[model samples]
Target chain A: MSPKSVLLWTMQAAVFWLVLFVPQLIVFLLVSNPPTWELVLMVATGVVGVVHTAVEPSWRYRVHRWETTPDAVYTLSGWLNQEWRVAPVSRIQTIDTKRGPFQQMLGLSTVTVTTASAAGPVEIEGLEHEVAQRLVVELTNTTQATPGDAT
Target chain B: MTTPAEVPAGLPAAPEFTEPLQEWHRLHVRMLVVRPLNEGVAMLVPILVLLFTGNGEKWRLIASGATVAMILAFSYLIWRTTRYRITEEKVELHTGLLTRKQLAVPRDRIRTVDLTSKPGHRIFGLSAVRIGTGQQDVPGTDGLTLDAVTQQEAERLRLVLLQKGTAPRAVASEGESAEPVPLPESEVISQLDLKWLKYAPLSLSGLVAIGAVFGVLSNYADDLGLHPVQDLWEWLFENPSLALIAAFLVGLAVVGLILSVPLYILQFWNYRLTREPDGTLRVQRGLLTTRSVSVEEQRLRGVDIQEPLLVRAGKGAKLAAVTTGLGSKGESNLLLPPAPLSVAHQVSRDVLKVGSDPTTLRLRKHPFAALRRSMFRHTVPWVVIAVGLAIWAPSWAWPIPVAILPFAALVGWDNYRSLGNALDERYLVTRNNSLVRSTVALQRTGIIGWRIRRSFFQRRSGLMTIGATTAAGAGVYHVTDVGESHGLALADEAVPDLLRPFLVDSTVDDQAERNA
Candidate 1:
């Protein structure tokens, strides 16, 4: 697991929690006489927020391990249920590295591997620069060496 | 990154050719003069019309002055924007006044070079050479305008460019005799017979009909007071079960289709296709303004065979090829319109180099699976529509459901009949359609990714859909109507094994060579 991925996951968790709870908190504060239910909800949200922050480090560690594993890059992400996409390194055609302002601030980069078809390029976000470059070089060499390698 | 290297100096070296500046200078002057005159008339016509209708002098004066100013601006821009150079490897064009823009196109990408002369240009012996790559955003802008070159020189240039392995040289060095090396002509496997030409116009009419309907709708909207019509349009869009509106639209479509038949037939009256000596196919068509398009064999992505319901009844199929170019109207890259089923197969084998294998797998038709899948996808929408109509108007609810049944049944029948897939060592062909049947050929090397999808209900029913993706274009080919085990087996085993031979490891030509 790269240190960069841990930072990224922590950032994501922070953003997610803020987006989910901030508006509700603002609305509760705006009310003239806050109801008993609103008070209870606010306390519950505060507890959840504290728990979320505490668990974030471990979550980041799990995400980092899942991202860097060489077996297959599995994507289990969606609102309703996780849709698993397992693409082996061999099937990858080209690997592109990109870093936006946010990622650059966090000293992280993203690696996107594109195949021939247009379902879209599979992206693995938030990796250390050196690790990303190494992965790209290694994949390219392996793909070139093995003929008809399907991952 | 590779450095830009000079073109190899392997062929017999010749003196560089320079374009005559006199012709371009004359062309520039003529364009400057004619452009203003045309603009003046364009401006004058509206003012004259307004004057006859008793419009105010203030409006007329303002319009005329604005038009004159626009013409002056355009002419000045054209006069300032004139620079061109001919190099050994490419043609360089420099145009623009304040901020200059330069464009360079290689001679190799040029498929056809056409020299056209309007009445005025004809008198001046100035012809515009329209270069077509069949991939440009604009139709004729990719070519260059030669000012006053002789017809003989233009012909010579065209011949030199068209000939394989012959490098383009300047027209000024005609006195020095250069040997024209003779290259073996490409063998013509087959020619377009009368039968093939007859079907070429069917798809064209379909396009014209669609265009006409849109034109009519726009015109109607303008006549009905644009703002009010726009508000009405928004209202109509929000309402789903507007039968009267749908019926009116269907009527318009039928009328458009009817009126477009003659236009298509006229356009394709003298359709002809010839195999060029350089192993490229050249197609020439059009009645009033003749146009020619050439497709290189190597650029062909895949051959598509379509069997429309009517054509299927007559035992005929339409054959086309997907190529790497922008098609007419920036819609599709289908090269051929329609050919006989047998001829399509033969051309696919010869021109596209798609070899035939006696052991090629036959298409498997899963009728039950197709029916169920189609019912799930297509019938559900219609049923929903019916239910919505019932809820909206309780009085007509019973009749709406009865009316929707036939539509669902027809859709399911079409899906069951049309869904089929054929697999071989090199290619995977899937054929499916509701109204217009389409057979897609995907080379193993061409496939980039694939997915196997199964819903909870589908998983219980032992049915799944496998989708294959390709870089050539969007639209996943759904290998629908397969049992769960069969679909999983294909995704897990057969597909990878079948594609293994032609994947990134092997070259495209190697498979062709093996098949040959």
Candidate 2:
């Protein structure tokens, strides 16, 4: 994982905290009824958010891995309840690449692989842009219903 | 300047195409008439209520007539605008007045053709033709339909769209030549047996239908100026207790049977499954609104026999076709109507084209930890609720927990009893249930992946959940709360060599399972 990806994650966390905390702070100030626990919660959330946004990505990078076989594309992801997903090459209906403004700034992209499974699509995030493009090409080729690739 | 038809887009580029494109076709004029009638039928109840109560009020009568007229006018307008064409290469549709939407789907990509006619459409001998590619159409459903066409036209369109002239069943290689076209023949595998209706009330759908009826009644109570359930209570309060109770009992019995019988008849009235000579399965069912669905035999992965709570009690189960595109539409996926277990097996075997039923595998029992995990899971919530209530209310709350304990225990015990799985050469059979027992006979070839999950609580109990990832049936068929080693074994065995690379020795995982 890129160090910039972690930076991007921290910015996202900061924005989320601002959106949530700012509203609550405004409400409390209007009422003049801020509780001590609210202040504690605010500090706790910030400290946890710092640890999560700054440190969690590298740990996540440890558990996350993706592989492709002739028959399927496998994704192993998650921190707590790890999930392993496999989308078969023959069944792959669509492959798409998404680059959010922040992700574009960070030079990262998320590749979404969709199949007929009810489990929903598998998204491989934090890929270097060049790698994401190549992945899309490979998957798109597979999705075009030509199964005779000797590769 | 040359016409577009003269342009040889590459003579042999389109393998599915042999002949040239057919001219564009518009729906029958009856579509304009039938479309409004369908909408009018939906508003029938409200109109009936108004007519019965309004006593010829001028404004009320005018409002009803105007609503019907507008609907009829709009249907005619849309029907006039819609057009569809069948080319050897693809099926193209041009629709919309203002939007000017055009959709073209290649012939090989055409997955299923559904022909359904509601009572209103049936009156005009029309059926709604939905050509689904088994994928979500971009923007809207205009990509895949002719709203209402003549029944004969719909049938002819279905045949034209589905015909694969030289489309190879096997992987196409270079230098393959003119394969002779075969004659079209259909063999009926299973048809609706009225005897199956005995199991209809046993289906959970009936109870759900009854619930929906009551819900609608309650929602529209004020509008209708009547609340039947509330009225019954008021009458009961005014009458003697024993006689009223007897009357209520009789009334409930009659209402339940009346409500369920018609629903069953309408749903499975002419249910039939047939196979075409060129490997296609067709299903036809329903009464008032008849439906006919055609699915390629290649798309069918397996069969799912679902025995809901009531159905299981009566030894009946509903059979559904497990296919790739068949996932989104639920009821139309029925391969077999709810019937005796013996009959369900017979139908399934016929559908699978095998002499023996794949579901009849001797399933291996789950480990004892499975039972322990379920018991602990079921018991904890009620126990916690009971204790909390006792602390708050002291006397009365204690009895609630006591009353709930045995039932929870029974449920958890039954859950354990219901869990079993067996892996044979061809099919992976897994059975799990508490209230509704769903035993799925999933084809091994259909399974593309395996998912092994261990939640915090499950890890503590040295148990895990394993499921097979398939394109068919709910995608994944899970075996929950099995011992960690056992679950891993099942996952490993599901698609051999696939999970082997991801997993280490079961002993190492069990240690991590214990730690977690």
Candidate 3:
């Protein structure tokens, strides 16, 4: 994971926490009678938010890995818990590559592989822009070449 | 790749049919009669209402004639625009006037040619054709339909498309000879006997149908005006009494029961399944509105036999196909309608014909840890309700949980009893029950991968849920809450070699002692 992506995540988390925290802070300060426990809990939320934003992106980056074989694409990702998924090239309905502003700044993109299955799509994120583009083309070619698709 | 075009066992090879009759055939002209008749009836209703009330007399006669002209003219324009044709490789339909749309589906991709008819169309020997490609139907793109064709034409269309598209190279080569080969007789495989109607009331369809009947009635009332049943309510409130209320409820129930019986009969009357010589399963049924649906043999993965709680009490079950791309919308692909348990099994075996009956396989039971956890989970709600009721409203609801505890315990026990899974050389079977007990027999060849789920709670208890992911059926047949190692081992055994890299080292002392 790039330092830029970590900074982006932290900034996003900071905005989300601030939107929630500012109101509670203002209400407590304005109140004539404030409970000590409520003040302590409000402070705790800010600390938790800061700690979560600082650690999560890099920690997730450590555990996440993905690879595409000739006939299948596999992804392993999660933080507290991990899931490994394999999507056969034959069953792929479409492959899409997307880049949000944060990813663009890091020169990274996400490749999404979709199938008809109800388990939803498999996403391989934080890939370099050029690599993700090439991966999409390769996966698309494999899908088209496989004639007797199961789904 | 396509198989060698072998027919199902005991059925003779089918004769070759010519290239399906082409050109934009606009269904029998008589089909144009149905819509105009409906429009006429709708227009007639207002005229009749006006005449009965003895009002709007001056223009009433002219209004009737004008309405009939408008309906006939509009229906004729619509009928003129509707057209369908079958080419060598695709089925196409074109319809609509101002905003027109043309839909084309590849013949080989066609999953079902569902023929249906209303009583009006039936009187004229006409039917509607819905060509199902087994994909999620886009309103215009997927469900290509010809609103009305002669019954005879519909049958020939169904036969020609299924035979050519399904048989492919064999039929194409055979047709080249242009030889008049003798057609083989399709055997009557499974016919629903009238005695099976005893199982109708046992179905949840009866309840759903009852709700539908009420829904129709309410919708009709809304259309006419508010308070259509205001008099009935006034009478009901005015004459309320213990016995009268009992009689009223019983009367309403009887009405619902009456609706249920006819709806059941209409849905499943004379249900007959036939095996065409070309490996197609044809289902024909319905009383007022006849239906003819065909499922190709090549798509058969396996079968799912369901026994709902009420149906089980009567020793009856429902059989549905576990095929792919059958457009999972409000469709069960009823291979065998609700029937006696023995008959259901016999049909399942006969249909599958894969050496042994996968339904009868003795499935492995889940661990006691799962059952214990479920039992506590089930009873906890009742205990909470009991406590809450005891402290709050002491009189009425206390007896509710008095009866609830045992039922909750029974539900947990039944759920535990229903948990089982077995995998072997040819097929994998799993049995489980929530309200409806389902035993799914899936072809092992159809399975694509394994998804093992370990939630935080499951991890704490050393359990995992393993799903056999396939294209057919619900896409995943899950065996829940098995021991972690057992789940991994089952996945390994089923797929042969896939899960090895995912397993932890043998040096760790795991609780899955029974995995071996």
What TM value does model 3 have?
Answer: 0.79
TM-score of chain B in each prediction: 0.63, 0.82, 0.80
The 10 consecutive residues of candidate 3 chain B with the worst lDDT sum are B502-511
Whole-model lDDT for model 1 versus the true structure?
0.55
Q: In model 2, how large is the Cα lDDT of residue B450?
A: 65
Candidate 2 per-residue lDDT, tens place, B1-516, comes to 111223244442222323334788787788777877877776777777776677688988888888778888788878888888887578888888889889888877776788889898898888988886645323234237788888877876776677664233322532332442333447898888888788766664655776887787676676877777888778866774887678877776667766777888888788888986556789998889888888877767788888887777888887888775442554767888888888889889998888788888787888888898878888889999888888888475488787989999998998898888888777888888777788888888777566666776676777778777676657778877777766777767767766664566346755797899
Candidate 1 lDDT over residue span B1-516, tens digit each: 122223345643222233322222223456555456544654565545555545566876677677678788887776667665555556566776777877666766655555544444444444444444433324435445443244555544454444444333324355432432233453555544556544533444555666766676666456444655567678766774679788977876666556655554544445555565555565545443333455554444555677666555555565555543323332233334455666656656665565662112377776475577677777777778777777776564557676878877786778677777767666667777766787777665555455545555565565666676554433246677677545545554534643233232224544676799
List lDDT for all candidates, in order: 0.55, 0.73, 0.73
lDDT of 3 by residue, B181-218 (tens): 44567878799788887877777575677677667667
lDDT of model 2 at position B336: 84
User: Highest DockQ: which candidate?
Assistant: 2
Give the TM-scores of the predictions, in the order they appear: 0.63, 0.81, 0.79
Error of model 2, residue A134, in angstroms: 4.6
Candidate 1 local lDDT, A11-90, one digit each (tens) = 66677677767877888889888788887877787778767766765554553322323433434222211122334555
**Alpha-carbon DockQ of candidate 1:** 0.19
Lowest summed lDDT window (length 10), candidate 1 chain B: B15-24
